[model samples]
Target chain A: MEAPATNNQIPGELGIWLFVAGDLIVFSVFFILIALGQKENADIFVQSRGKLDLWVGVLNTLLLLTASWFVAIAVERCRTGLGATASRYFSLGILCGVGFVANKSLEWGSKITQGINPATNEFFMYFFVFTGIHLLHVLVGIGVLCLLRSVSRSPGLNERRIRTLESGATFWHLVDLLWVVLFALLYLL
Target chain B: MLPFFYMGVFAWSGTFCYRVSLGTWFAWVMLLIYYVVKAIDRVEQEETASAQGQRYALTSCAGLLRNLAHAFGWENELKEKNVDPLFRKSMVFCAWSGLIAIVLFIIGGVILGEMLPPLLRANDPPEEFVRKVNEHLLSIRIGSVFLMLSFALFGPFGAGIAALTRRAEKSPVFSYVQLVFTSCGTLVAVLVAFTWALMAFRPDVYHPTTVQMFADFAYFLAVFSVPVFGGWCVVIALPILLAEEGQECFPRWVGYVNLWAVLLFAPGQLVLFFKEGPFSWHGIVALWIPFVAFFLWILIMCLSMLKAVKADDQVTGP
Candidate 1:
């Protein structure tokens, strides 16, 4: 996206920022809840932390980060009027998103098959609920990426289309950013 | 005056006698008939005045009928006269329905129903659940009555919103969608109240597990049914967000508010997964966040709708 001709210009419409800010505050609360849970059940949390496959978490993190990167480049391409090229980047971003979803489902499926679920323990409860919510975001982000891809393939990007593109990208980054926190909190920490 | 009399008598009977007497029911029926007659009388007056080419002062009942007529897309019939004030007044009243609902829900569902600190946890034993229900049986029954009344007001509240949305659109598709979802959401809320009342209705006769089942149904109905409520928010937000500049139904921030509500409510779906902790029915994410968000959404939408109505008054003049 073109740099704001003036510093006063926000990256996207002001409305999206309102949504982003509200979402971030709620996620902050989720993180705090996790911290409190970990403090109260340190042993259970630690034990459950070991059972998590670190590599799966690592793969998901990389996939989301790569997707975010592709989306960022796509937004820039759209700004430079490279609509065709931008469409390609959005597709790659979508591919990474699909990969993340597939990997996440596999991880969840294996856990379920092993008789581990949200109700198994407090730690798994947090793990499943929080990650599950984040997974929802990923799914939404992929749909949004598809929209951006189609928009990029269209001719003559107008100011409104660009705004839509920017807002969608911002949302995708939010999904990516949230997953990063989820990966660290649920897995590494 | 009659409506006030009806309310006063009903409230007095409900509080003192714990039951509405036959007299109160007769009075309620009379009030309904009065409303219908008064509404028709005003419409006849308007017809005569217009035939004689004289403007008639808008009465309360006539204003309501006009608002209803407008809501049903009969605007062409009333296009000649200045109906802005009447429409604005009715819209304002409809907007306040949401605020009234929030206040009543707090009193009826949270305070009186003893749901807020949650009377029983999801994993609590059935006997414990029954014991608690028995203890608060009177309050629960009374509260459920208030809750049912409060939740039903959402129908009018949603109608107000859909009406405003209809004005902003060239076609009324989203407004209809909003109305449909509003009915669904309102029904879900009323079902919550009904289920709670059922839980307390015959706790002595029913098995402990039966009471527990009722509690489960109530909580799940209230919290876990996210899509209906979320869809309501989405339709509200989408119209505002997609409206062309200067043609928006609500302010852009209001759309964002609805979007935020949709996100906050999503956690409610997790209540189905966890029986305890923050994801449980009684927990912060599952219950508190969504509950608080819903009222806040109602409050914001109410204020915005009121503001939008007032803005219409200025644009169209007195």
Candidate 2:
């Protein structure tokens, strides 16, 4: 197999890139919407923000970042035809996703137990709704990575398959990136 | 009665108004009559199939009929051809027929239904609701006619989506699935619209409780029937998402749009839990968001279909 001739070659399918771009736009719009909501009710948002456990947000952020690193390495290994190492890396990446989900569930469970939900107030509404949507994205990203991991383990993985792996990795990274912003916006800010 | 006969004639003729040949009018009329009969039978046989189950079966049957439509569209083409050039062009035209339905629904549902009876936001008292229904009886009657016309267009819209989705497969399985989901969705739309019509038809005659019951029935079905259309989105999006690199029926962005639309539609389920606020049938979360998202979905699909049809036209130049 020949290496890609161009220095600036796109890593994945054009389709995935289009999807990622759309996802980013949607999240950006959500961020803006929440910011406006904060402006309207600063006191409630500030109080609600304080109620959140910042450590959980930080921990989830770190998990996603580490997951991104593992997936990046996995994509490189797949491109280099290192099937076993790539599979191992993908497994680690998936574990990180699981960790993030578990952390999120605990955080939400704590809030619900304290009688906080979307209908609690304007701040909690945005917190729950936006995070709920982001959590969905994270779940889907994990599913995509799982499929890529299995595909990576095949001995007959081809150039096209490597590109597909890279595409899936890009999406996983986007999920992480969005969570980082969400962590800061909802939890830190 | 004379006006209704005129509307029926208009609607019947409207079926043939698509770029479809006049020769097929007889067949289209027969199909319409068959569904009308089926819908009536389903209504009468209330004990047999749950409303949801009946809708599911009806949609599946609609899917089969869409396959038949595809067969007719591609009669002269190769057996393995997924999309006919003619079908691509005509399907867009058929899809635009939905605009007729949209206009009618807005007029009937938004303007008239909401005004006289206030059927959608059912927080009013029995006497108040009954009094309003009686007050503007004529407006409600006129609105129901437009609503009926609107629901009638789902047939063409389902057929159009099935035909368009054929671009993704050599076999007609996905297309058939699209058809079935869309067909059942149409039935739900018609039934809900009919409930509103039934409420308005004899507002003065029926007891207030009976009128309120019809309103509740219509709102619940209209708001909660998300899965019906969501299934249509899923089947259509799967093909586009999985289609080979350049062979995609529409751009990949359209598939993502479908995904987002499906997500937005998910909130409709909240209606069952919350009777007020954003989760209620009239609330922002359940009714408004999903409704807007649906129209946006329709608009984007229309644009994509038209673009595909134009590209096909260029490929098969006159």
Candidate 3:
């Protein structure tokens, strides 16, 4: 999907961007809190960070990135009036989102079975809570993607319908972007 | 004429016995009777005028009162044309309740209750908790009374918002949702104050652990009941966002504000998982952020509702 001829218009409704900016600021605060926690308890953070399954985090990261890509393409296709193709791309994005959720649940389940929980330590506390919150975003994004898929199949897409599609796609990309940051913060950094 | 004679007699009696409470009571009773007579006279005149098919000017006192009511957007007759004047006043009253609640909260929760520096941390020993409650027993009792009154005011404040949402929607579905969540949120807030008061009620008589339990209950209720408050925000935002353009009771940005509030409040849910750190009940993320955001949200909604009321008055020509 080629970029729609570069117009001055911003993608999606302006209200959606307001929500995105607010959400990003909130995640920034969470990131700052994690940094402060790591500063205060460096040894414990590192020890717990070492215990996390690195491969699972990397896989989830890739899954979300791929989902984001599909969503971006779907948005472009909808904009360019290729609604049928956009529907297909939205399904692919939803599939990737489901995979990410399944992979995250397995990782969390394994850790819980190992007697590690949010109450285990300060590091694990931030890890579970922040990632769990991000997981919720992914779930919501999947639901949004499904809605967009139905919209893509509807005939004679109007400006409002296109705007809705773009907004949902923006949210899906936010979920993916946040997960990348979470993956880095929790699993790598 | 009879009212004038009665007023003169009452005024004379009040001046003759000005030092006694009886004079004040007599003065008040006379003023009440004067108003009642004037009202009855005006109603009788209006009835006779309508029966005779002629317009009648109001008597001076009643006319002056009508003018005053219209100036304040308090006239009852405006109800037929646009928003009810009494309903508008109720909305304004409810909107101000948010400010009242914040002021009372600061005084009761922060200054008097010793919650600002957080007298009791989640990890504090039971003895420390009991000792702190004991230290501020009288103040906590007084403060909790203010706190309870403050939180109770949120019921009307929420109703004000829900009432506005009802006007915006074709169906009252979201308004009812908002009302349901508002009750839940208000109950949670009142419960927080009630539990704090209970902790201070008998800290001396109860075991240290029991006082500590009360503290925990208060903080948890305040910070951890996220869904009630968050759901309230969701219902509020949903209607504003979903409404057709130019049909929203609130500006679109207010919906974004509510959504931001929901995100800010989400951290409060983590208070259940941690006894220490930023996510703890006493910590910044769980308590301070949500606490400040909740009041800020109220303040914005209050200002917006006031604006809407003024706009409605303007469009409808008061």
Candidate 4:
């Protein structure tokens, strides 16, 4: 009840954390279910996995990882009062998101052709559900970055500029984190 | 998949999404429930007027007893100056919301059942079908019940309470609770629609071919997350309300209720992950919400009393 913060309180780390929490809970649940179900249909999942070209997942992962790195640098610049520079880097981050989605589309197309219908195999079903849902979030984050770059020219924007970078960075990193857990669970392990 | 340009416009502008495929059978069912509640209100009002003439003070109060049970020791708390009046009112609304949720859930479920394919019923005569029915029926029915209740009771109750909790300066968490609860309510409404869609889309689920059943169930759960993704808002927002009065971060009861949701949901989602051939994941999904919802109802009663106990009696005549 301390006189409420105004509509835009220069949305801080808290905003990013909340977004990450929701995303993480969802992916975790989806992955955990897949893991638990894997035991019930290991052969089905493994065979389904064989059909998937994980090189695309690998490329998507690297793109996201690299994007998060560049985004971090963008946030560091914003902290140092380099707003214009931060804006430029955010555009680059958006590029990374676009790349990941393109690769995903190719990967998805091949699977559909191979008759790996999500409903057919438990593994393939989760594969489509989890990744497809995640791809949507990636696009959302990309859109956020693109939007941030557009109106970032106003004076005295620095105080909250880091937040713009931070939310996008948080989302990108979470995408990477999920892929990491997913890579091991889905591929190597 | 939405195109890049569309995502760009929505993301940059922070679009206001008021989507609910409103022209569905569930929309009609919701209208029916609304009409029934209105009728009940009118008839009850007339009965109250008639009974008042016969008895000096009507004591055949069926609702009154439940109201009393719902009342936490708040009146005494108010007398002793232990809580804030605004907080007390909000808690009182929470109690009413809980009650409305239970009643509406049953009504929604029965109405929804009217639309389902007759083949989904447990009474279908084939033995193989009967075996699948027994395996999946309980979980399916229970999930369906909670799914309906989410619309009828849960979301509206939260939104109603948050609306009542309005503050001139806006309590940060409290103000946010309104949007959160309203979204929760809306998600439930959509899920109720899907129940009819999936069943109607595949009436032969009662006697599905092996490949057909697997695809049907998998596809349903995947799409069904339209609600889960939305429902987590409650999980997120409840902590904000429970964090009031600078107590422990979340309401002690909410942590308990969430734990209940998890306890109920986790195992079922897991079993469902493995359940094949004529099982009811939807039913399993419904069973988790009500028991914990009612349990939270009890907690609100205790909180309301504690709130009343904490009420500041000074300048209270207003």
lDDT of 1 by residue, B1-318 (tens): 777676766756675543234324433443454464345334534534443332233345567897999999897655532356777888888988887897677668766776655888999999999999989889889989888988999999999999999987877899999999989999999999899899999998999999999999998998898899998999999999888755789877678779889999988887776787788899999998888788778877887788787666675676
> Candidate 4: where are CA atoms >4 Å away?
A1-12, A158-161, B1-91, B95-152, B155-318
Tens-digit lDDT string for candidate 4 (B287-308) = 2233233333333433333333
How far off is model 1, as Cα RMSD? 12.5
Worst 10 residues of 1 chain A by lDDT: A4-13
lDDT measured at residue A32 in model 3 versus the true structure, 0 to 100: 90
- Which residue window of length 10 is worst by lDDT in model 1 chain B? B49-58
lDDT by residue for model 3 (A1-189), tens? 997678534577655776798789878988999988989999999999999999999999899899899889988888898888889999999999999999999999999999999889989989988998898889888999999999999999876688789888988888888888878888898
Ranking by TM-score: 1, 3, 2, 4
Question: What is candidate 2's TM-score against the reference?
Answer: 0.69
Clashes of each: 0, 2, 0, 18
Clashing pairs in 2: B59-B184, B63-B180
Q: Candidate 2 local accuracy as lDDT?
A: 0.74
lDDT of 3 by residue, B1-318 (tens): 686576556756765533232323433443454454345335534534443332223345556887898999888664443656887788889888986887687678766776644778998989999888888899889989989999999999999999999987767999999999989989999998999999998887999999989988988888788889989999999888788644777866578779878888888887777788888888888887888778767877887788778877986778
Clashing pairs in 1: none
Better structure of 2 and 4 per lDDT:
2
Task: Give residue A160's lDDT in candidate 2 (0 to 100).
Answer: 56
| Candidate 2 local lDDT, B20-128, one digit each (tens) | 2221332334344335434533443442233336357566886787688687895335333434656765777776776556556666765665622234465677787
Q: How do the residues A130-184 of candidate 2 rate in per-residue lDDT, one tens digit apiece?
A: 7887898899899999999998998887655776798789889999999889988
